[model samples]
Target: MESAIKWTSNETVLGFGKDAIAFLDTKLFSKKSPCDKKMYEILIIEPFYGGSHKVLIDMLYKALEDEYSDSKICMVTMTAKKWHWRARTSALYLSQVIPKQHAFRVMFSSSVLNLGDLIALRNDLADVKKIVYFHENQLVYPVREKKDRDFQYGYNEIVTSMVADTVVFNSEFNRETFLKSIKAFFKVQPDFRPKGLEGEIRQKTRVLYFPVMYDVGSHSKDYESTLHIVWPHRWEHDKAPEDFMKVLRKLSEAHCDFTVSMVGEQFTDVSKAFKEAETSLFPHIRHWGFLPSRREYLDLLSRAHVAVSTAKHEFFGVAMMEAAFNKCLPLCPKRLVYPEIYPNECLYNDSEDLFTRLAAFSRNVSAIKEVVADVKLDFSKYSAVNLLPHYVSLFK
Candidate 1:
């Protein structure tokens, strides 16, 4: 069976909306498995196969398949939509869909799926060497209010990590934050509190940077005088598009010579700032909305002088790394994974600091250009060439 399942953005499965649920023919994995057949060496199971999650799986499958041509590998993935639903019910659905009798040496999945529940439901996979990768832990996931936070999501992560033989995180910050917040996250529960969960989870945890492949594009020299700023992130509340727009608004009010390209994956729940920006920052808008083609997105990044990230919640910053690799100066917040990935020169302490730096850069584009050219932001550690071998070791 083909590893990837194609589905249009507007297409709906059953009565569920386009983003709610996806259906796949079970016959693909349901065929009888004989005892004499060679056991599958590896299994890649991704419940929320979208965004960075999908990218990682696709990268792993391609690299592993190429490396182990003689061995048999199986992959089962669902579309990346309705993330909450995927987290809640994907284990049950995938448990039924996955082959029962097939023996596998290693199994890999993201934190989105409840590995414990899946193994409990499908005993065939209980003996497999389970590896759970955490892209973002629910413990540190930002919400407006403590009451608004769902206890089950964070609890699921704890349970998933507990059951897995190895728990991999994209960054040290992610691993530490998730581990530290385990006890506090469960404080919402009145009684019967869990203890020593963090220590147990810590034993199995390791940090692995998300592998990124960069295609160096021909930098556009047409708009050298005007500083081109790109904000490439999801159109969601967590990304803090509102704060980004506010900074852009201040720059606009100051009459800074800058063109803005606001591009990233858009979903049903879009931040109101995007709509407001269309009217407020209309004249300065250069390229807006998600670009379907990777080449075009890279080209846009190549053209831009500055790639700004106002993300309130980010675990591993793939987009910012890509932007930096494309020769764009990355201006990110001091907190989160930014400090780990980017140099102090590229980080801002507060919104006022962000505005101050951008405004100064806008007045003199050469300074920003020189800084991008001079600053040696080494992305070698995060490149696929350096990291693929590490990932390949996990399967063995």
Candidate 2:
């Protein structure tokens, strides 16, 4: 927990392992265990894509480093395709983003890695701690919903997470769903559910909400438009784009003076839902697709009156937080993790309720801000300051 490794590398040394020359505190360094001996080097199992996990990983790293600077972190990722983050010591096994044919060969194998600094257990690690984390996994995952690969990847996540010492979830919803799925899996293959495995899992399992990190960069833009609604989620089905399209069409028929911005990544194989929205509501859309500059996107959210999320499932809505941090009211459904993240009273269960709320917001936009203020979470509780201790306790 204390600063074990003296951080020596600057930004230039971080891109690749070229000069990953952080000083190792030999006096404190343990021979094998990467604990607080000399330097506490930790290995993080990165997500399939760059999104909320990236922010979580960054926050965890910073919070851990505030005291443990001598520590090292190695990220283990399946693909570097869309991942641009740099960790010199990371080990990439396979590109989960590539076609299934080519991916099978490169998918991560625990055999090839060096257990280095600390092997933060991940998918398919064959341990209870890691599997619990895998089971608790959530975050509007598009790849999981869009693809059908017999879940070789998910299987890997289950195995990897099971082996770790600490199994953590970003939200309680994610943790519970994972365990339920596992129990169901065991029902089919009863023998695989080891004798005392349930109790062990409960003991090791933890629900540690990830801290959000990333600047709400300076962006001052007063829109001429009266109603600025933002959908900052990815251009995918999880966001329920088809339903959002229907909302737009209904709102249009109502002749509401509103402008919508569709920000976030758009994959090559864009789904039917997004296509329908693009084709039908192209005129109403002001900005479409991902913007690399955080300022530009934050500016868009800041200026917007409402941040709408029509997600079918969200482990934790990072985009929702981005909007809320800047006073943009989140209008989301009372499903999965949304109610947990936002307010239970503010959630809408179906299209009728969502539309009803939207129509009301278009008339009294100030009500959106008022609603957000009323249910706004204590920022400190979700910050690195408070969250890190809870997270560290899991490791203990």
- Candidate number achieving the greatest TM-score relative to the actual structure: 1
Please list the residue runs of candidate 2 whose C-alpha ends up more than 4 Å from where it truly belongs after superposition: 1-9, 12-40, 47-49, 76-154, 188-197, 214-225, 271-276, 392-396
Among all windows of 10 consecutive residues in model 2, the one with the lowest summed lDDT is 16-25
Error of 1 at 305 (Å): 0.4
The candidate maximizing lDDT is 1
Model 2 gets an lDDT of 0.53
Candidate 2 differs from the real structure by a C-alpha RMSD in angstroms, to one decimal, of 9.9
Model 2 alpha-carbon miss at residue 143, Å: 12
Per-residue alpha-carbon lDDT of candidate 2 for residues 129-187, written as tens digits (9 for 90 to 100): 22123322422234543343234333434544444455567778877776555544444
Those runs of model 1 whose alpha carbons end farther than 4 Å from true positions after fitting are 1-39, 221-223, 269-272
Instruction: For candidate 2, give the lDDT of residue 28.
Output: 16
